[model samples]
Target: MMKLDGVVAFSMTVEAGSISQAAQRLGLAKSVVSERLAELERTLGTTLIQRTTRKLSLTASGETFLPRARRILREAQEATAELAARSGKLSGPLRISAPVGFGVLHLGPALGRFLRDYPEIDLSLELDDSFVDAASGGFDAVLRHGAVGDGRLIARRLAHSRRLLVASPAYLERHGHPGTPGALEQHRALLYSNRTSDWRFTAPGQGWSVIRPRAALRVNNGLIMRDAAIEGLGIALLPSFFIHQALAAGTLVAIDLGVQAEGAELFLTYPKDHGAAAKIRAFGDSLRRSFGSPPYWERVEPAPRAAPI
Candidate 1:
């Protein structure tokens, strides 16, 4: 039988894309991680990784062995967690990924509460807007907005996401309100760097209208785009979570109410292998209970406007 230690070392190295990163995460010396990977390769009779100074890439044989090895390691870890859970103890590090803004605004607080509730579980979180590959990133789960395209990752619905087309009221008053999505083409737009500047709209008893508007400024962060909109730079399409206060205070108004976008969904995704892990299960349950029913964050009543500085 293959050695369990060697299998786990190999999986961690591949997932982290470097022996150094794996060693850091595993709290082992670089030499030890390298030794275990070499040992595993020798036992399997194939080289798993083509290591270079810049990055590590898997060989064909390594690619073939990857999924199975990950599954084996995951199952072993889950069994250990399950045994702990049977004793009313859920203990293990749970790594999570999320977009930077949301991670700071919402997830950070939630994780603090969860950690306090489950003292045995350790938590590590990474924040970025880029799409994360859970298997490669060593994440137990990732909080993602909109739908995920990867079929291998299992997605659990966490909340409903609404996208809004908004601009500062001053900007709207300066430039007349757009009556339809088509009218946006004539206005200055603030767009996200990662996505197209297309806005979709549907009115009651009307068909879909798609608009690909021009952008005056394109930025990578949602917060930046929202700031630009607040400063009267241009109109922006952002997740409703980001603009709740502005919309509620009437600082930023939704231009065409009936012609707004819909169908953007939110999910908490994880590798299919992590489904049975106790920490993952507990956190998922906590998240569902905290935000799933009626989605309190989304249901926030419009707050009164704050005095401008």
Candidate 2:
């Protein structure tokens, strides 16, 4: 009989485009993964992959066998999911990836509740701002904000947010608030390094406007940017979810440019096949419930403004 481990190892290596990456995803040693692939080739009496110093390519036989191998893996996963569903018990490892700020601010509580509800499910959560390929990363799901561009993954909308321009009252009092997007070019901007410094806005009469602000400080983390903005460093265009607390507390004030900023759609993304996994489904549902329509973080009322003299 063909060894299932060997078949899986071969398939994962092909998908990952490198043996090291495959080994990382499989939680196995690189040598073990290579051995499994070699064992599978010997059992089949055929060389499936061509290995070279630069890259690995599939042999003609491998090209033909790749789809079959994937199908086998899919069917095996579905079989396990079916059994788990029938038994009505979610027991397995569920790996997830999320943005660092969101994971810290919101996912922690949601996960606490999820863990209590499903004690048998094992959870692994990775937080980072870098883009993660769900398949290669071996993540069961990824919580993402903004557009879901990958056609290979299925996305479920969790909540909505907006990116707005904000500055501390002290900063605005010192530097003066810009009445239009064009004026932002003169001000120091605290920017998220991963994103463009150019900010965009739209309004009923204003149509659309974009401005490239001078970056006084650029960092990968949103929390750092938020802190800088609070310290009166400069203006920042940040996700509403990230600054909601500060905004509500009157530490940060929203600048109305007579136009609305872009809306951010939050999503929980996963492979289509993973939709059948009980753990994935349960977790997804819990997130939907926790975030609700407006999301819990957004539930606070706007801070009361001082009366005009």
Q: Write out the backbone clash pairs for model 2.
A: none
Tens-place lDDT per residue, model 2, 1-309, is 688899899999998999999999999999999999999999988999999988999999999989888888888878877677556567778899999988888888789888877788889999989988865577888888878888888888888888889888888888887877788899999998887767888878656777889999999888999999999999999888899999899888888777787787888888876644567777887887877778866676557654211
Clashes of 1: 0
Candidate 2, poorest ten consecutive residues by summed lDDT: 300-309
Q: 1-309, model 1: which lDDT tens digit per residue?
A: 478888888899988879999999999999999999899999999999999999999999999999999888778878888787666588667888888877766776677767777888878889988878865677888888876888788888877767888888788878877776677899999998877667777878988888888889998788889889999999998887788777777777666556658655778888776644577767777776766566665786555443321
TM-score for each model: 0.71, 0.74
- Cα-based RMSD of the predictions, in order? 8.0, 7.2
RMSD of candidate 2 to true structure, Å: 7.2
Total residue pair clashes for candidate 2: 0
Q: Where does candidate 1 stray beyond 4 Å?
A: 1-88, 204-207, 303-309
